[model samples]
Target: DLDEVINGALSVLALEARAKGLELRSEIDPKVCTGLCGDPGRLRQVLTNLLNNAVKFTEQGEVVLRILPQEETSSAVSLIDGISGSQAALRFEVKDTGIGLSEDARGRIFEAFNQADQSTTRRYGGTGLGLTISLQLVKMMHGKIGVESEPGKGSLFWFTARFEKHAAGKAALAKQKPLPLGRVLLADGNATDREILRAELTALGMRCTSAASGEEALQFLCGAIADEDPYALAMIDMQMPGMNGVELARTIKNDHLTKGTRV
Candidate 1:
């Protein structure tokens, strides 16, 4: 499944990201086809390579993976060779908040055995073959790959690939239940994780509000109760700065007005 492919890629580099105190998140467009006919192994490899590089270069902040369906048109279809009737074009992006690349560095980024500069090689050791291999794999899958970056502003690496939809999976997805509407409060110190969860919850037809700390969450909770629109659920991260998840849960439980809200 396409989900497996994306998750697998992330799993391989999860530890590395956590080691650097970085948040790893994904924002997959709901419209993108989930079950696709393609080489999952190669797809995972390409994704993992990009993510691994992103995590390695980023010391703090977050790394994000975004997937979206590309517009299908006559010209687009013609560009991707071997795209059959069942195939669809999709775009994958790996964005990072790390040391960005210069104009010269971006030009030869995908070249084998090369990096931004000699100092970069000394600072972060690598053969610089990852992007080169990713380029080859993307081409094999009838896709195009490129990068965009500005010095000190991080980078966004993207690629487009074509995959044929799985007939059975599409039918199963069509029969899934409709999403329920509800209000949700997300409390997390990590900006990236909060944003990711908010996007996902919003996509599921829930109204979401985010707070950076337990105190902030409590304020929102009480305000929501006063508005007569209390949140149906509060998703809290276990490890937070000011107050942890357990503390917040207890606070919510003790307050009679907010007690009714689920934690």
Candidate 2:
């Protein structure tokens, strides 16, 4: 689950973080268990909520999550503290260095119907359900939730849980070889989209040629037939002024010059 939660959270946060001019950093300790007995979907949801909170609240500064093995397990703690095996479990932590809280606000932070005060909500917008959901999720896994904050500083929220490893010595194999480049003809009246497509397609190791209009694409196809270069794909946007994408594709498909062509 190490790859699962982290990957999904990063993917979900990437777009939002970019829009805010912030960096989402992650450092997962090597010793942390990749195999854990837990609900992946719920874990992802918790991560998403926490990440979204960090991004939404912070105007500047970075948001980071560090995953590591718990130093003290319940069973180990029993031996160290001379307590019985009836001790509670352990879980992981999600901490952020943005928008800390005051002493009074900390007490009722994780309550189901409680959240940061109206001023905090006014400065930042949210339904206040994110932390509630996150707290409950940790509780469901037999864990405890806690937070540390300062009024002008930042906040560190953490939880702990115990999990059993179901699979042993399983490795995620990597696939070999890169995808082959596709030959593409990009046709669009909008120069920006056309250029963007051209750049993206070129980045994908593709051979892409652009046309300003449907007529331009048709002329390009006609020229390609004369000079003999094959096109594997044609992308034509339909809203162009004249000779739209469909017409361009039809012309290419029905042209006598391309009918018996081999390329």
Candidate 3:
């Protein structure tokens, strides 16, 4: 399954991301097909290589994997081989808040045995064949791969591939248990983390309110209680600037008014 492939790739690099205190997140579009007939091994390999590089280079912030369905236009349909009928055109992007590449470095990024610079090779210690192999594999899958980066900002690596939708698997997924409906409050200092969580929760049929800090979360919770519409859940980030998640949870638990709000 496509979902399994994505989870497997992320799981392999979870420890590395945690070691650097980086949050690894994935945002898959609900419209995207979960069961696809394609080379899952190659897809997993490409994702793992890109995610590994993102984690290795990023010292702080987060790494995100986003998958979305691409519009199937005439050009898109013509690009994929053996696309006899309707196929799912998917775009996969790996974004990171790591040290990015310069214009010159981005040009030669996919070359075999090459890295951004000599310092990158010495510091990161890789043969630099990951991107090269990823490019080859993507090409074999009749996909296109590339990257976008700035010297100090970060990088976004993206690729597009086409896959035949598996009707049996799609039907099975459609019959899965429906997501619970409720209002959820999300507390996270990082804007990206908050947005990612919010989007995922909203897609699952939940009303979401995002707070940038613990203090802000409390205000929302208190207001919701006063309005006689307390949130059903509160998802707090453990690491924040002030108050933190634990402190906020403790305060919520102690306050009788907001105590009913699950955290």
Candidate 4:
């Protein structure tokens, strides 16, 4: 999933790379991850930040996004419980040929809103929040993000996010069991997403049901409560045909029967 997310994000950058006359290369290990139980969106964000930074700085040569599996260390294992299920650690690196950084610049680069130098913003036109956000997200997933750069030799920005390996293929996906969180109500206007979420949740042992819109979800929730079997989780879309997710959430919170349900 991580590799897929990275590839999807980078494919869009191919045009930008071509415009800049640099080769954007991806070398992902086939066995890097069989399954990952983290946010694919955030993973894409991290990759986007690193790759965009790489291309922004590099005037020539290639920008490579490489993934390799490794053994998780004691400290990392103790910190992120997610690593316990992982067979091998996943290491992602974005190596580029660019201006590089000084020792002092490298030290504070990961700090919130700080870049290599003040001149960088003037030249690059970013608010320097990308690395800060990436660092926070990587930490949340129980991973580490670092860099190795010299003044003239360019830089290598890397991060490690452990992946939980399971059996490969579609059968594996079908067999995936999510952690049970009781009855779950998936409310999405999109049929495809609703089906996918329902399948993933039901596979995890949750009693799953779907509604096409917020109104439908609310009506079902009310009916479930009247039947004395209330939903414990409501996964609603932000935008829908009827009342939106936020309004539905507010209504749920204010209602007596579903006040305590998690949304």
Output the number of the TM-score-best candidate: 1
lDDT of 1 by residue, 156-185 (tens): 999888888899767766766637999999
Tell me how candidate 3 scores on lDDT. Answer: 0.87
C-alpha local distance difference test of each model: 0.86, 0.67, 0.87, 0.78
Clashing pairs in 1: none
- Please state the error at residue 130 of candidate 3 in Å: 1.6
Q: Over the stretch 168-231, how does candidate 2's per-residue lDDT look in tens digits?
A: 4123212222348766788888665676577657755788899898888777666776787766
For every candidate, C-alpha RMSD to the true structure in Å: 2.9, 13.3, 3.1, 15.9
Name the regions of candidate 2 deviating beyond 4 angstroms: 72-91, 169-263
| Model 1 ranges with Cα > 4 A deviation | 72-85
- Candidates ranked by TM-score, best first? 1, 3, 4, 2
lDDT of 4: 0.78
RMSD of 1: 2.9
Counted clashes in each candidate structure: 0, 5, 0, 1
Q: Estimate each model's TM-score.
A: 0.88, 0.56, 0.86, 0.57
Candidates in descending lDDT order: 3, 1, 4, 2
Write the number of the candidate with greater lDDT, choosing between 2 and 4: 4
